[model samples]
Target chain A: MEIPDKSATAPDFAEPPVFAEPWHAELFAMTVHLHKQGLFSWLDWTAQLSEALAAAGKHHTLDGGDDYYAVWLDTLLQIMIAQGVTDDSSVQAMQEQWRNAYVRTPHGKPVRLADDGAD
Target chain B: MPHEHDDHNAHSLLPSEPALRVRALETILTRKGLVSAETLDEIIDVYAHKIGPHIGAKIVARAWIDSDFKQALLTNAESILGEMKLAGRQGEHVQVVENTANIHNMVVCTLCSCYPWPLLGIPPSWYKSDAYRKRAVREPRAVLAEFGITPSQTQSVRVWDSTAEMRYLVLPMMPVAAAGCDEATLARWVTRDCMVGTGIPKAPQI
Candidate 1:
């Protein structure tokens, strides 16, 4: 079955507030700025995002726009890896380090990375 | 002894997956020189305080104060906004809807979260959720009630599901007392939910 083009229909949207985390907007602007800066082309970004969306569609029912950025970040990571901007290992390393940090933090406390200790 | 440490202390931690992902992406991009730390800092500054619904409030404030602009915004948002840098990126094409004593407008992206980023920054979590997308069209009255908005029986709700190409913003009715208020003061009456058509502009403080 072909993927239904969502942009075709202009259903009346609702009053969901703009309460996304500041980081969400940060990630969004960062990507847009990079696209503008020509680190990657718009076509390239869209193609990746489309492919990501199709794959996501195959896996589960999409929660409308809820996971849009999650898919977006996935596509971005894939592209960055493909372009050799950074290696997958480095990405994994960072993820692991942060996960470790989160696993140790308490509820409502500011989670922090240990100092580089190079000092 | 310092060299023995591996970029972390035993007790320290990160807060969440998203925090990790954002930081990791930033680190990678900065390391590769694809984007500068300054660029990130500037964008973050805007995210923290400047962009998002605040821009929309400013636009609404302008509309409230200027009849011609209000007309332009209602008729052809893209054409009017095209003159300024405000209509870029996700806001390539926007159609503004007005909220009067009779009609109320709201926006959603049933397929994806296609928001007017240039004006509203990133969308709030609730706007991007499936529940709102599904229910917004089916039971707008209930949704409005959830937001503490109880429109009169004569009031009609109109939802605009934002697509990848175009988006929408609601022009909430100007409060009666807002007539003489300055732009900033008037803008304060415009909440983020008002742009989504879920809330109404409040009167200036007592």
Candidate 2:
């Protein structure tokens, strides 16, 4: 089959490279850190991710953006909970703590759980 | 894009849901002494700056100028990369497929984004796009066309599906115009897309 010349077409390549947001990188690093800490094996991690992707696939097409990373985060949480590393309540509590910290944090100041009187 | 609103203020006082979740997870992990913040920051820094397409470019450039290295790369990329201290994490197993006059190779992770991150860093957003993952295999020519890459009729397109077990990198053919160029000069011509097979290395400008 003769492929037509389509060199003139220009697709935008100016989009954010690698991580679009700080949290994406943070979430990714945390997963890797846990794996390195023997919390879960890489094989286990990939399996969980694959399962998450399959589950997500049932809803809609994954854009591999926030939706994809959301699945990634879910996989991390699932593995962590399954491994007895942490549970839903603790994660929720920490999330609430962070929410409060960030809300009260002044602009350009670092948000920390310590600042919010939560350890 | 779901993150369009957050884009307006990267440092917004109101953190997004994902941001909060990440922070929560980090705190939980840190409190238990399971992980450290410094290590997390180091890992992120490595991916953001230390590792990327430029590393792959150097490998590709060396292969272009050195026949022995090229042969070694195609046969056992993982070991060659390991010898260079570039093999680890997502790059545990890698295969380098060469582009020739008769064959062209492209890569896609139809299941999820299983790229050789140690070499290419995090994949470009488009590589993970639903449209790309679905179409790249079903209609490679058309998808490549969208990337402005139209392989000639005589050159067959072969799409390699990347997975957690195996990853593939396309060793683009050195442009004829780049003859006699040094490795550094040759590396400059190779882009991330070239290694991914979505686009070819740019011809050197005279």
Candidate 3:
């Protein structure tokens, strides 16, 4: 909704932004976008995220599959963006890209980001 | 047909769906070395800006203005946020750290993205970087420099990596000029870098 100054650092890059509200889908959407854009190879990302979780497991002395996945998603986006593979914009751009890349038919339409029902 | 959709939704919780298309791009970029700083900025401008910090600013503003709320935030973050009806769906147990000159804080999920979603809307682009994760804990000063933050001789920085059971978010100290400022105005000062403990909140130019 708000476009920060481009010169200003992205919250994910420089500072974490605090929100008065909760937006879980938004977070999921970001990850899905990066995943769509090919910032990190899925296999590499999955392995690293799993490793991050395994490391956390040692620290907390607990099994953290979901937490590991969440961290993986977070880290995947972070590193990929850092590496310049694809960013928040590219992730967001996936919608338009997919729309343009895929053709729609009368029976079914190509997947749009909002259509993560398939996800 | 509808049942098939439901079945997909059921399996969504499992990590089976490979997040196909994005991964392909990552492969290409990896081959091309396209994940540079400038390209990342452009990428976030498109996608991350869609949701992350725009939401985070409001949370920073509220924390600056409210005292009892701040104390409540410091302890039992999840329930307090739930009382405000802002607890995120997956934000299980969240914690807030106050960043001060004497002691600064940086958060990482050396393992994954275990962030305090109730307060900070989303983690930043760099927080997820392998270089950042590997270097931050071992070589924080160097990483902080990339974000333009260099601590003074007296300051000590502490980095915490969030795990599922415990997630962390930094409560950057409110600026003096920010006193009596409205939430929207105050939010402007809460830069994305500051929340991650990469930089200090900049003072207004005279």
Q: Which number leads on lDDT?
A: 2
* Candidate 2 local lDDT, B39-71, one digit each (tens): 989999988777788788888989998999999
- Local distance difference test, candidate 3: 0.56
Order of the predicted models by TM-score, top scorer first: 2, 1, 3
* All candidates: DockQ: 0.18, 0.32, 0.08
What is the per-residue lDDT of model 3 for residues B60-140, given as tens digits with 9 covering 90 to 100? 667789888778888776787678676654435667778777887887777555565545555554565455656789988
lDDT tens digits, residue span A21-76, model 3: 12222334445455556654544554566576566655554322334334545565
DockQ for model 2?
Answer: 0.32
lDDT of 1 by residue, B1-206 (tens): 45744444444444456657877787667656777767867776765555667678778988999999999999989877778677757335788899888888888866556677777777776675557766888998898899898888897888898766778888998988678776666776777778878878764342
- In terms of docking quality, model 3 is incorrect
**lDDT of all predictions, in order shown?**
0.71, 0.82, 0.56
Q: Pick the candidate with the highest DockQ.
A: 2
Across A23-98, the per-residue lDDT of candidate 2 in tens digits comes to: 9999988887877877777776777787778778888988888888899998888888887888999899888988
Query: For candidate 2 chain A, which ten residues in a row score worst on lDDT?
Result: A3-12
Estimate, for each residue in A17-103, the C-alpha lDDT of model 1 and write its tens digit: 333454465577678778877777655666567667667866775554436667877788888888888777888887776676566
Instruction: Sort candidate 2 into its docking category.
Output: acceptable
Model 1 ranges off by over 4 Å: A1-26, A39-70, A82-90, A94-119, B1-10, B15-18, B182-184
